[model samples]
Target: MKRFIGFIKKEFYHIFRDKRSLFILFGMPIVQVMLFGFAITNEINNVDIAILDHSKDANTKQIIDKISASKYFSIKDFLDNERDIETAFKKGEIKAVLNFEKDFSKKLMTENQATVQILTDATDPNTANTISNYTSSILSSYQELLNKDISIPYQIGVQTRMFYNPELKSVFMFVPGVMTIILMLVSAMMTSISITREKELGTMEILLVSPLKPFQVIVGKVVPYILLSVINAIVIILLSIFVFSMPVEGNLFLLGAETILFIMNALSLGILISTVSASQQTAMMVSLMGLMLPVILLSGFIFPISSMPFPLQVISNIIPARWFIIILKGIMLKGVGLVYLWKETLILVGMTLFFIALSVKKYKIRLE
Candidate 1:
């Protein structure tokens, strides 16, 4: 019994001594709990919306006040004309716009009825549906309050029009997100393991002693993976178009160019991973486990970033997938060109360059 107890004590000491093991034991659970608890909510919080109140009546003012008071929404801006709604949506500033019909109070007094139009961007159908439902509930409550003191029942009709995706198809949202995830994980995983495999086989030394420069070595290692990842992207886009019957509303040539840039970004990230890791297993684990959650959650793939906490929203900005998904939706659904998407495109370009330069620096450090 004493011998067995000593052995157990020694194993515990060994586990406590290893930093990686300690992180796996304690850090992983805390991170997973925090992320899952915070990032997985279905309810919308502080969703940005616009107001276009043509009525400017007492009733319309009261409804606007009620909506602004709700925790689920934030009034981003007030549109002065009908033409500004599209501009708001294309700029990605607001999710929905509330248009109060003219003579709202007059209609309510004479006819006991009025209409409000809810124009929502349905690129993300779940959020659009949620916003519409929540807005309608608030309107219903106001209607009930008005009826409580009067003999006549009042009705506020809500007419919802989903923009970008009129049908609110789930596939339209998923395709861009899935394509980003697959290209990112696959490219990173494959390239990450490649150099690590070489290191484990003892061929990394031979390549290091060869005439190739550090950047050249890194580029040569990643070029093939970039090509493969691009091919994978092409296949996915084709499937999204043909199999899912998804519409490509923007320029196909531009889409192709952006896809290549994203693939290169993913590949460079993989090279960075392999350069830092000592083994294939380590590289593989870092590529898959370290990246999976952030890509899915923080990239605005499943949930709205604006709905998350302010910190998470800020952290999401650094994620390449977030920018790429924006580009995809802009081109595929909104039909916006580079003129409008320049910021997101520039972001991807900067990230790709940063990853490649950092990987080269890490590679040169290793050569020392």
Candidate 2:
């Protein structure tokens, strides 16, 4: 027990002595939270739009005023010709173009309806769709105001219920993803680098020459990381719950268990990387380039798997973080239990086993 305490003390010393590790350990969580919370968001606001109003009429003017007044869009430019629309878009000044047809008010009075062409830059499909929706909503509201005295024969109303996020807060979506990324960074990247550091410093050889078995040394190194990762996970969860007011619908015990499992899986991957990499830099690069990229891109954190290219979709199936993220969303947001997340749990377990097996094999080769 005294020896174990001494080992843990040494581990803490190593952690605190290294400024880079300390910065990553403490600063990364806050940075990730801030980046996800403020920088990366799906919600659209203050979109710049250009209007080409050939029709100098009250109705056209009214529509333009309504659009400009609404919070979603800001009129960036008033163009005279269609050619300027393309030029403005090329210059990246406007996201959308609202073209009012000639004699818009006269046509509306004579024909009861008028044509207004909305030409949008579809390069960013999401922004384009949002701009279109906002424009349509503003026009509809204006029409409703104009027809306040008249009553329609039939009216259809859409009651939209955003199931998981009623407020559509980006924090709810990002908390899980940020947690996953931090866990991956701490457990996988840090462990891999730390383990390889021992090898590079020639301490691993002395440890191997001592009474400590290869497995024991590896376990001792990893156990502390696992504990630190669990603590970090708790810190992040508490921040999300108290600060962000995020809900944890499922059992907290189960969430903790699954988080430990993910950390173990990540730690196993780190061990495998350390076994293959001779230097800490190589391990860090491999963990970031190989593991982090996939976890962020293909894990359905930032992009939907269903919308990805078929090959990339298939490739995403093998990424352990993908399964972990699904389980997280299910338990945290959807309020699902072991029954729904069992398949993902099994996949994570399988991955952990595979990583362990590969590491053990490589370790034996080095020994022989």
Residue-level lDDT tens digits of model 1 in 1-368: 45344434544454457576445434443343334334544558899999999989999999999999998899999999899999999999999999999999999999978999999999999889999999998998998899887675485656879989896666678778878887788778777876787788887787677665676666666765566567677767777787667789999999999999998998899999998898989998998887778999999988899999999999999989999999999999999999999999999999999999898878843444
Show model 1 residue runs off by greater than 4 Å.
1-157, 364-368
Clashing pairs in 2: none
lDDT of each: 0.82, 0.86
Top candidate by lDDT: 2
Model 2 agreement with the true structure over 6-58: per-residue lDDT tens digits: 66677777887999997887788877876887778777778899999999789
**What is the TM-score (0 to 1) of candidate 1?**
0.60
TM-scores for all candidates: the values are: 0.60, 0.85
For candidate 1, give the lDDT: 0.82
